[model samples]
Target: MKRKLLFGERMLLGDGTEPFNAVIPFRLHGIFKEEEIRYALGRLQEKHPWLKALIQYDEQHIPWFQVPEATVSIPIRLVNRENEDDWQEESKQEWHSTFDYQTKPLIRFVWIKGEVVSDMLFVFHHCLCDGGSAMALLYEFLKVLDNPNAEIGLENPILGIEDVVPAHILQSGKKQFKAKTIGRLAALAIKCIPVGRKVIDRQTDYLIHWKFDKKTSEQLISYCKSRGITVNTFLGATVLEAFRKVRGAAAFNKVSCPVDIRRFAPQIKDDHIFAFGLMIVMSLNQKLNFMDNLRLMQTEVERKTAKLNPYITMMVMESAHDALKNFTRLLKRGKSSNDCMFSNLGRIQIPDQYRTFSLETVFSPSVIGPLGNTTTMVTSTFRGQMDFSFMGSEGYLPQAEALAIRDEIIGRIRQQLDYKTAS
Candidate 1:
């Protein structure tokens, strides 16, 4: 479809801040002919409204999908099948993929026809869909490829921004809710408790990604389970341990690990597909031994993971939005309080068969972050291996040192396992 950019797409163009997006891979075995593939793409476009449309207007990053309601209807690109040369040149332009900002959602495919191999990639705005939505997208495209006559029937489409109320409006009993939310954070920042000297870091930053074989990732998971510690905590503790070795013990003692708030609730929807997490920092006032720290960390991770609530996180995000929109003070303050951040998407299930083919080792993509000195870590377990990727600015933490830190932590985990066996 031919059209001007959608409002959400334009916001990204203006701000130059693409939300970190995900990439999906698919393998094809000879099924539908090449002519059939092209026909399927055209047919699929008519079936899925999202495939043919773009955002009408955007408030912040939220979008209101508009259907033009007029003489001319805007159309979106249906296929993003690019060759290897294109991805090579494109990768150079996205130098920030290593560290500057989050990845804009995109899919890169490796398709081979006869003796010729073709590499195709597609990028989408994160505001448009999450990982689950991407899964749905894959099927939509597949349906078109499988049968040009297939109909688009969405079990549940991506939620419109209207589905969620802006946080500013407190329901009848929400006034007190707002007060408590603000009160807790306010006390943390302004209270008599001395968190520590706040350092205004003014350093340029960068981030890069790494991958481990599927076997190693799986082994790590099994090892963690044997220890009765969550894989995330095991990996998280590894980071803290590495920092303690490099930045010194004092640094590691005070760091907080990120906790995803989804599993904490009894009936959380798999599609509540938004970000919600908290970091639980430890007190460094006292000394800690290596073994002691690990035991303590295991306990902390379990407790905090259980206590998180999505409702509260959603409420806080809305409150922050209201603060920025209404109060000049918060607008000037920039980002809400969040020091270092980490997230892990356990294991994404790959389809058993795709066009009569299967996935090889899934290539892990790196996440980009704000240039501010903030540190962020992301992990995904594919097959039996757990892959860890790090993002940080060169100004705050050198890439050379960051890689060394990762290695040392992995070594420590292994060392601990050895010590137990000898006994």
Candidate 2:
């Protein structure tokens, strides 16, 4: 089974040299046998064809996911867990490790072995899946790991662009003309745009993680609800404020948020391995108070999200394949304008208890690639606690500064909650 790579997937695949990886780490508290893990992985591969497929390039250098006659099992690397923080170190290591897409599957599993507790890491190339798909896979993995006979449903994978966009839209000559015209114009703009001759030196990348206890998490959620703003918008405002406070004049005052394409396109299921995403850029009003700014930001987020046309965006992108080199060059050389990309996976609904092992907790996933700015903040709530993973490079944001920003975020959240309580 095989399918041509989508435009976004091709861009992420890059020369297959740099690693664009995402890591999902969770702690399981119980004894787990290697065979059981392998069994679960095998079931997953059988369910999702992409998990067993490798990448191959045609004469035109276009990439396609090709499945061999004998599918290879997903590789598992077991490491003895030396300390509680070992997963963080391993996650950083995985960020730089490139997948040999030509010979191996784009996904791998890392088992941090322990006496009775194990931290399992699911590391996959970003091109293979998004956070939504990862969560679905994780949910299924836990189910099958508990019971090898668990009947987790198989995925009806998206084959190509036609599967995502409606047939009517694709067949329309007027829309095709618009897509081609816009794509060409955008490609021309990219070529004409002037960028720095030298790319920003993202010296050393690092991940900073922290958690808010249940009480604080609930209070923040209540605060946002009372103010008629989403937790995402509230956190987005908080992070932007933290950057502005920490970096002072250096802050860009803009935060980019990636919206899941599944929300716009119902044809893409939760379990499908796909990575196309729409983005919305947000900024706070300097003149307004924090609460007022959140309301404004929420309004902006909704407006921007509503206006997102994933179908047309995908069409325009697919039409501009010839200009991908120039677009990539601009991303590599362009001066940074955004503060950071902030993503909130919201609450993970997977149960903590299983028949064999009890899930201790889930860490907010982290991802990094050869892209221009390596600054990203991801938040997710599990078991009533909100977890955060803030990743950045030393060249873009020093470790000390990242720590300060983390502290600033926590402090701001506490302050807001306290004020709301007082009132």
Top-TM-score candidate index? 2
Off by over 4 Å in 2: none
Q: After superposition, which runs of candidate 1 have C-alpha atoms over 4 Å from their true positions?
A: 1-122, 130-207, 249-286, 325-339, 417-423
lDDT of 2 by residue, 1-423 (tens): 899998889888899888999999999999989999999999999999999989999999899999888988999999999999999999999999999988899999999999999999999999999999999999999999998898998888889999999999987898899999999999999999999888788999999999999999999999999988999999999999999999999999999999999999999998998989899998989999887898889889999999999888999999999998888888878988898999999999999998878999999999998878989999999999999999999988899999999999999999999999999
Alpha carbon lDDT at 210, candidate 1: 56
Model 1 residue 254 CA deviation (Å) reads 6.3
Q: Worst 10-residue stretch by lDDT in candidate 1?
A: 98-107
Residue 118 lDDT in model 2? 96
